[model samples]
Target: MRIKRPVKVFLLGMVAIVLLWVIHSYHFQNQQFQTDRASTYSELPVAATKVVKHAFGEVTIPVKPQRIIVLNDISLLDPVLSLGIKPIGTVSYLPQYDFLFRGVTNAEAAGIEIVGIGNQPILEKVLLLKPDVILMREYQRSLYQQLSAIAPTVVIDLPSLNYSFKENLRFIAQVLGETEKAEQVIAQYYERVKQLQQLMGERLKKIEVSVINVFTDGIIATYSDNETYNQVLQDIGIPLIPALAKQKETSLFLNIEVLNKYDADILFVMSESKNAALSFSQNPLLSTLKAAKNHRVYTVQQDRWWTYGFLGVNKLLDDLFKYLT
Candidate 1:
């Protein structure tokens, strides 16, 4: 048997190709192990640019904010969590209510540190946490400068208790770069709204409703045309009393006698249960209103109405429909 040089060369070339392929495969596997894909839960794709406006000033949010702090309302917390981002801290103004975290895990597991109770967040403590941004309501703008000096803060004020929860959820979703989640949430809310609207519109016959807020001190406050709740009422085809329809000059205390000036078919009174129940039970004047006489007076809890965030509005609408029917 004669050994040919070309055959020897061919055998060596085949061995080299096999070894190279094995090495390439091993390297690829190692690269994948180093690049972690487990933690990314739909992070925003675009670079978070500077949002500047006359009212909000300049806010620099990382297109993807890893750490966040929530102040003011706990109601808005659920949507943030729903978007797959957790807050490092939150306010403990009301401890008992749990509507906001319906689908979230146990409070202990959620691990949301309590930053402060009622008054605005402790500026010093929040600065220490080094949050990328802070969430706040509109009235809290007084602390704008102090907060902005520490980190970017978003001041949200949706006019009217009737402010569409879906719209609100969408606004927040946009801010958090969770447009898909927002769309899904809004769609669900809309479905509920449509069903309620159909039923309430048919049975109530476009009845007028008024949302009143009362304090323990005998001061009465009713929603103005611009309030979010009013918008919710209008959405269901409910009419607002003439005076309420005309936006109030102010948002603060008014006397119960003011209710007389703006009469409506249904009256939605909001206040602390203890105080509202006491007023309705004891105050002859409050009991004299037409709605009260007919038992149309529905007392809603302030905490629930005030803090329900985006989904809260839907709950409110559902309640209204239930009351109307």
Candidate 2:
């Protein structure tokens, strides 16, 4: 009995030592884990950001966004591409009419995926892209919230002005912190315009140019000051028909019976359908117009003719020189 008591006491002492050792090791390990975690996180640098105010609301965005996605082609993508930043993705309604966009770089060839048709975007593709920023026009009011959830989205509600491209380009530049580049681009564009003015000389002031649209449904109409061709014509000191210059609406519907109302010294038709263009050209009444008699009535593609903004205007200049010179 005396030996048993002594052995029990010795065993209890050993057990207590073991418990103490275990507790010490666990505490040391937990502390080492915390220290390592903090050290690892501290090694990475924080990303810088800036706040920008847009049509929808203010949004905080990374200063130099690595990935950008454009939702609207004509209004949004035009300016984004004009600023020289190739987007990660964009939406185009007419992929077949990509010649208008070739000035900026072929969207697919430049690695810009078509997220969806027209202004609509594929949310799943957007999520996979992990874009740092998204640019769009206010035409996508329904999609603003949904896109913002994925990234910092800036919506541009452009005013309906004849010279809206300047404002559009400047606003996009401000959003991207590219004001200097914008100014440079603007200067370059105007320099080209100046060259055109010098090349065309006084003939620009004499000839009355007009843009008409022949819809696929056989509707014939002429564009007013808001059209890209009109904008470029005005910039180069070209005279537009009185009906087009004074008109407020974007398009003026004209009855084919009174084709004289659509007459101009030089006429450019934006034909959406081959059949409609053929019918318009074959109409006996068209021969009565001075443009047709002089062989100055040209049929143009809607996508190429309607594209607006910096690169778009430059493309128009290329066409103008082809026809006029």
Write one digit per residue (lDDT tens) for candidate 1, span 113-227: 7676663577778888888877777677888888878877876555532345555566667667778987876677667767877776565565677777776656777655556
Write candidate 2's Cα lDDT for 248-305 as tens digits: 8766776677567768999988776677889888888888999998999988766566
Instruction: Give the C-alpha lDDT of model 1.
Output: 0.65
Task: Return the TM-score for each candidate structure.
Answer: 0.69, 0.82
Measured with C-alpha atoms, the lDDT of residue 269 in candidate 1 is 74
lDDT of 2: 0.79
Query: Which ranges in model 1 have alpha carbons more than 4 Å from their true place?
Result: 1-54, 74-84, 94-110, 137-168, 250-252
- Clash count for candidate 1 is 11
lDDT of each: 0.65, 0.79
List ranges where model 2 is wrong by over 4 Å. Answer: 1-44, 94-109, 160-163
Q: Extract clashing residue pairs from model 2.
A: none
